[model samples]
Target: MSERVADSTIKGFLYQFNKTILEIVNADDEDVITVEGVVEDVDVLSASGELEAIQCKYHETKEKFIPSLIFKPLLQMAEAYDRNPSARIKYTIFIYVPNEDHCQKDIDPSILNSALATTDQSLSKIVSRISGKFDKVEFLKNTRIVFGPSLDEIECSTKAALELLGIQGSDVDTLLYPNSIEKIAKLSSIKDETERQITKAKLYTYLSSATHTAISKWTLALRNRSEILKNIKQQLSSYFSQNSRDRYFYIDKNEIDDYEEKVVVFFGNYIKKYYSKPSHVTAPTFIINDNIEAIRDLEFRLYTKGIKANTGLVGNSFVVDHFFRDPMKKINRNHIEEREFDLRLLAMDSEQEAINHRKGDDLYLVCSNTPNNIELTDVNFYQVGISSFNELEYVIGIRNSHE
Candidate 1:
């Protein structure tokens, strides 16, 4: 038996981190804007050529306002103002901490007042105390700090944003952040349920330990703004496809061609041996099961090859269960044939017509990695294909182990 790892505290923090971003994007009096830069944690570019840069900090255990924590963001804001002389760019230090008392009473007012300070001496003294940097009252005037949105505020803003953006889903926890959604989409490409669960678990464990510090230190290096913006736009554009029918069990596109190659090699040889193939016959193309559209194409090819393949789940659930429990145990010469006969006798026919097409003496093909070997009496009525994902893993494992 294997020991399961404990979930980390940072998982909750990541959730809160995204919610904070959503809140900032749809802040009151601000139209939802395209994030324009990679310099700040959250950069909102308004239509009127104004910029609102927001730095998000989530410290749940900290009781007091940390001065040193605000320094880098403040310095960045000062530099940003210098870079863009014409644009009315503003900076906001958005803090989300568990200690609401100090934030609500002291930090909020102090930040606003310091930003509006008329005298250079007062602003410089405050800046020197916090960041060891001084001068530039004009830059300080455009900067502000405030406590981040509360849970309730986040909830309200999320609902409004979803509606405004025409997104429909009952999942409350799904943040409207582009990077988060992209991560989910990437994970969806893993076809095996067990692999997906294990991979996500490892990812969460890694994220919990390392992601927070990395995110805080992100501004140390800046990526190309256009490329970052393009990626973000592309991800946001794919929101409609986030609920794709086979998203959870789809094969990754990168593996699709290789899977087709393997299928051609494996099944083409089977066809040549079992059924006579003319010299004029070309290599049969395979459609991955994960592709709903390509599955139809596969059926057409199979039909042309004098083999009709049915992948529907009408009467498959029972057979699937039977296979998992007793794949090698043959109750009858034709298990599917016996079941169909019983169903017809009882007048309990399946609504789906796909399963009725194949009958007795025909080999049942299951796409799974189970029952390493199978045997049946007279004509050997069973056949199963190793899942493409597992086959790929096996091939890779063998090659690596050989070296």
Candidate 2:
């Protein structure tokens, strides 16, 4: 594709991503958001169990609403309808035509029918596309065509929705916006449809814990930096104090070029402090985002430092298991299978491992940079504050106060 075409295509996906986030942010606690679901783009399963199927369309060069623009999308909806005619699914066509006066917020079925009768995509063709089945009146009744906000507007709506949910202030844009997008993108990108979905409870758990992100230093900025790291040091005291059960560190992939070194130092400091205390705490489960390779690389470094990890790579080969297990036995000083985690640093290959490994505290400290937020119901929860990793080092006793 041409550069401009590719850019437009990407922009279209961005619109869909932003729109999906808005639906999730505005949804009720029980609602679920599914990407690339029943319809082409996005779907929201409401608290009442009703499904709202959405198809988002954007044309930067277009001047007005074209009824034909929604025809194919409606056909996709029609096809879905044919699959289960009685399914309680609400079809939505979210479109944007540059001139507001020339577009519509709600589609007029009569106009839509008249357009279909004239356009090359006649009603009969739609039926054939859906294997000789289609709905006219019923489809229009269940279908909704509304004007979608621009990408920027949708992002603003996302921020606004977050504020309504109790997280507000300048950080909403600086930290929360792109961070939330990164999250939704991750969920939406998952290969499994079942895994490519999130509910309000899950999103809320992630949002509530993002306060630390508003202050931390990293390079994965979304918008222009006006005051991103502005006055960052002032907020360091509140970041992660050594005593808090929850500590979070935000490290966007590629955010730091020399992150392995930085992350090692950070993890090393926190690990020692966490285990050194009188509590039988053995180790801290390092929560990484979507990068397992980074986790493996990190394990090698930790092992070299006499600190080994239980990265899931074990069982792949004896060499793999031994490389990690030997050092862990020497450094962690406890059997990997020991259930006593209060004072035992544990090894984890995945988030599930940490969950299964926890013995005492139903709530344990999980530290990471933009951790893949798990549903609290699935076995996780968190809270934290920190301006910079250096500040975190000091608060967690990794760095001396005298320094």
Candidate 3:
């Protein structure tokens, strides 16, 4: 497993490093923004009318080297600039070696220079390849590469810059600050409630039209009793023939009726001991009744859990009317026969949380709300709610049994 550390620690280091570099470049006029997390090695962007990309690597040893690292990021930077011709970007690669003593003893300075020269050549080759294939207006130009000075030199330069800016050591210390444990504690507290709200929204949307289909199936099954019984008998016969005992004791119909009575009594006793009152009805009777109750009960449970019913509001209305309605209508058709049902619920909010209540799949965050106000029907329930995006604590309650 990879070593785990606080994200704030990483961010704090990057902030200080960026602060130090901006001072060294004397690019005070340029905007310095810390681009967090996404890119592999790149840390900060210094851009005025032109753009410069910087990659920071903090390594204790050679084993920490991330291979062929600069090639792709350089290509991406070049492409980013090409897309926006008006805003050109100049690329700079900074490899910070804080522990200078660990630097390979036999490695020649000239060879290091040659490797950088080769990387520069490779970057130009990449730009040429892209330009040849596509009609993009911007191609990389005026790109520069710099190897940061020794750690002592970097620290001295940074301290000098701090002094020049009239920043005290305490001020520098403040910039490297990490998030408090209390802040994390507060976030953890709300995380569960947020997850529950998200789950409720998801269940509401899924159960909206699909609940009708499940009810309709039960109703149809009751109406066509002969056909349904025939299918059930065939299924049960197949199951029992493979699993039941081969030897059969001869018994009269009266004895068979008596055995069934005792079996029912035993089942009732078992139910009374362990199961809830609603779950204790006769087996075949409960199967039909439970299907109807499940649909109604699910809606009630969702409401009680804090999800609102479909009120035909514009934001939440589209998903219920368009996406779920059609699929549910088809579910009533004759040929639809499946053991499991899969449904998607679009959250009432514009954000559109997607809550997927599958039999065994881990509940996960699939998508975030995008800027485009497009009507989304197939979104998971968790994506739409007010609380779901915060953190995934309540997802534990939304298991197969709960669904």
Per-candidate TM-score against the hidden true structure? 0.36, 0.53, 0.29
lDDT by residue for model 3 over 152-270, one digit each (tens)? 45545544543344323322211211111111122223434332111212322332322101111111112232332233233223322331112111111121223333323322332
Task: Give the number of the best model, judged by lDDT.
Answer: 2
What range of 10 consecutive residues in model 2 has the weakest lDDT sum? 338-347
- lDDT for residue 171 in candidate 1, whole number 0-100: 24
Model 3 C-alpha RMSD to native: 22.6
| Model 2 per-residue lDDT tens digits across residues 90-182 | 888887667654333556777555544544645557646554455667777888888876666666777787767665453676566656765
Instruction: Provide C-alpha RMSD values for all models, in order.
Output: 19.8, 9.5, 22.6
Deviation (Å) of 3 in candidate 3? 2.9
Clashes of each: 0, 15, 12
Instruction: Give per-residue CA lDDT, model 1, range 258-371, as digits (tens).
Output: 565554344434334322222212211122323434554544555565553433324524242221121122134433211111101101122222223222232223332212
